[model samples]
Target: MDVTQVLRMKGGDGDYSYFNNSLLPRKVISMTKPIIEDALTNLYCDMNFPKTLIMADLGCSSGPNTLFVASELVKSIDKIRLELGNYDEPPEIQMYLNDLPNNDFNTIFHLVPNFQEKLKKQTTPNSSSPRCYISGVPGSFYSRLFLRKSIHFVYSSYSLMWLSQVPEMISTNKGNIYMSRTSPPSVIKAYQEQFQRDFTTFLKCRADEIVRGGRMVLTILGRQSDDPCSKECCYVWDLLATSLNDMVVEGLIEEEKVDSFNIPQYTPSPKEVSTEVEKEGSFMIDCVEVSKVNWDASTDHNVILFEEEVQGYNMGKCMRAVAEPLVLSHFGESVIEEVFERYTNNIKISMSKEKTELVNVTVSMTRNR
Candidate 1:
């Protein structure tokens, strides 16, 4: 399947919806809150505050965290306004919640009234709060989504690791859905080149949308090691490929199908990200951090009792939420349960040995004036 057709979180508020199972991403959002706050505060101090503070959360899938971010940002801006005492009145806020066109926006919109009400209650009885307007901008973030020089701050969490589309014109790496150690040098190069192109495009587009001195805080799944084939970065896909190969051996799925399926994802190193930003020439990197999160951090169940089952089940569900749609799009939906069952077993065994983790890279950039 092509990148556009395959890339989306499992939709709806159902069992597999990102809303129901995106705990990892939700946690990442919380972890990055301090950075977001600091970036906003810095933006205000660096320039004359505007009447309407334009901001956007790119790749904001449908979930509670969507409105929660909006609420927190509005509050932070208000606090900064009061502390700085630069404006006569609190600035109004225009927040754009962005995501793919296929995202379940209804699920998010249903909660908007409550979000607005909460914001309203936070203000004093007589005093007015800053007017907050929330809207969804449905599209890919790799391209332009706003007017030139419009947005002041942009934030994306647990996104940007997703390539706009899978790399084109080569498929030597067989039986793997992503870049793996077994993948040839050509395949690795292809993936890296695609990332460079997509990320450069992303920075260029955001540069146009953001006003001079605007700031963006982005948190993405990344790799600490320079090699893309490192265990922390590519082991998940390796396990997935192993499961698919098992299916191939059992005649449940065709080997050719497995060979052709390439996941449109990339976990970049810190250097890779910084290089793109510098090459794009639109933004200067304010800060870049690479942190690690344990693979089982989101698993709250009793691991001692149902160690394998709990770990495997939780891991499967988490991955399914993010990749089920793509898997369904590529292979029929019928194979999803069986494939994940095998994947669960593999993860259960893998987790028993060494603790796996994900490296999260958060980059804060300011638009060059």
Candidate 2:
């Protein structure tokens, strides 16, 4: 799949919209608040407390959570400025909310006014009111999106896991959309090579944009174990492949079609990420942490339970929100609902045996001169 064109979270405010079903990313944002605040403080000190701060949130999708990191960064920077007696002449925060070209930029543009107003009210009147200029940048993060030595602090959550494109010449991983336990060593190597090339380019692009000593905080789905095919990273795709195979048996979709459909995504281990950072020679890894988030991480207790169908349904929504667009483009949208319905049932059966979750690897880094 061409990720730049097809990979986008479910858009708009509909029932299956990403805005409605993105509690997982929201929880991730909340959990990483302290990291963001700390990074902002250090970035301020690194920049020598400049009068203007340039920040960007890469892969920022449309939703309440889109501006979440930017909002927190604003508060943290403003607080620091106030404590340092610079409130009366606080820095201007130029925040760029970036996502794919097909993303719902209008939703974010419409919300900019409200976000600016909210930030204004959070600070005192005489405190120079840290001016926030929020704009939507539509492009792929794998390439250069900003000028050299431009941005100071970069934050991205649940985004870097998406590969720029699927690896070439992988004819062995039939009937599977992603890396699975049964995938051959060649398939695993293809994914690893793709991630390395893409991530290296990612670091190079950011290195040119960020100033020396600039900091970056990224959170993406990954595996704790060194094995790339571990269940924590690939089981969901395994179950998804199972559902699609069932459809093939029932003549809903052709077998060859399933064989050719591979998702352009990968979850790198901490070692993989650190190795890339070290090899890229532009950034130093500050911290790499792994956290488990249940499939249904929403606040509603009913949504987290697997005994009933509610949990499965919620989980289905979560997956559909991110996968529907790509699946629809390939499957013609006819079997979309049915595929998810079956996928949900599979999840219910699996979760009953054990608490299944995805591992999020959060890595904090700083640009090195």
Candidate 3:
């Protein structure tokens, strides 16, 4: 599916009522705070030199969560300022909030004014007005976006797996993954290729965009290990497929429509990601860890907690948040509600706080000077 169609299909006014707003930037920021903070601290000597450094949050979703990263960033930089007693030369940060063009900029941009207000109350001793500038840039992260050697700290959460285009192999007869029970070797290869392509370019672009000592902290869905062929591969792809399958069998959707669709493989093993980074040869990996994301607090009594937890964002984000339009293309709006119900039930059955976890990994690396 193209970007515009995707935005509309997954639009708040559209048929995707189950996408769940939880996937918005707010959750991501909450989810990724610790990692981002640690990286910023390490990069800027605990953010002491914020005015001199450049920090950018790329592919940031639209919502309050988007502010989470910037807030952590400014605070970290401020902490650094206090320690150095150079409160006068506070950090100058350029915050870039990115997303698909259809992402609600009104909501994302609103974060800036809120941030300015928050900073006003907590101004440091040496602080003059912070050189903190936030601008909304809409585009695919896979292509060129940043200035060469300009970024000091680059952070992205749950956003790198998308490629500029769908894998070509999926559209061909040789495509084994879309037709097979599990991800076929060909499909896996195709996705692996796409990831490598996207990742290498990402590193290269960052290498160009970041200064010599610049660092980046990126967290993306990753496999528990390097094995990509496993059935319990990636939650986004496999579970989403399973969800769609339920809809197909129930006659709510067409089988042919799904036969060719492919989920951009979001889950990669640490080794797989490292291999790609190594290919770029510009960044040195500092950390790669897979941790559980506690997104679902729902137990038997989901009553208010589930709704409260979900109410912050649109429900359309729940069922098809990651790939709503693609799934919709196969199932259509007629089966929207049922798809989300099945999607939720299947997840409840398959996932739990104790056993199954939202598998993701964080990679922190500094650019080669």
The candidate that achieves the highest TM-score relative to the unseen native structure: 2
TM-score of each: 0.94, 0.95, 0.82
- lDDT per residue (tens digit) for residues 18-49 in model 1: 77776667677778878888899999878677
All predictions: root-mean-square deviation over Cα?
2.3, 2.0, 4.3
Q: What do the candidate models score in CA lDDT, each in turn? A: 0.85, 0.85, 0.63
lDDT of 3 by residue, 236-279 (tens): 34555677766667876677766666654446778888888888
Ordered by TM-score, highest first, the candidates read 2, 1, 3
| Clashing pairs in model 1, backbone N/Cα/C closer than 3 A | none
Q: Which RMSD does model 2 reach against the true structure?
A: 2.0
Model 2 Cα lDDT, one tens digit per residue, 232-337: 8999888889999999999999998888888888898888989999999999888888787887674357545544467667777888888889888888878998
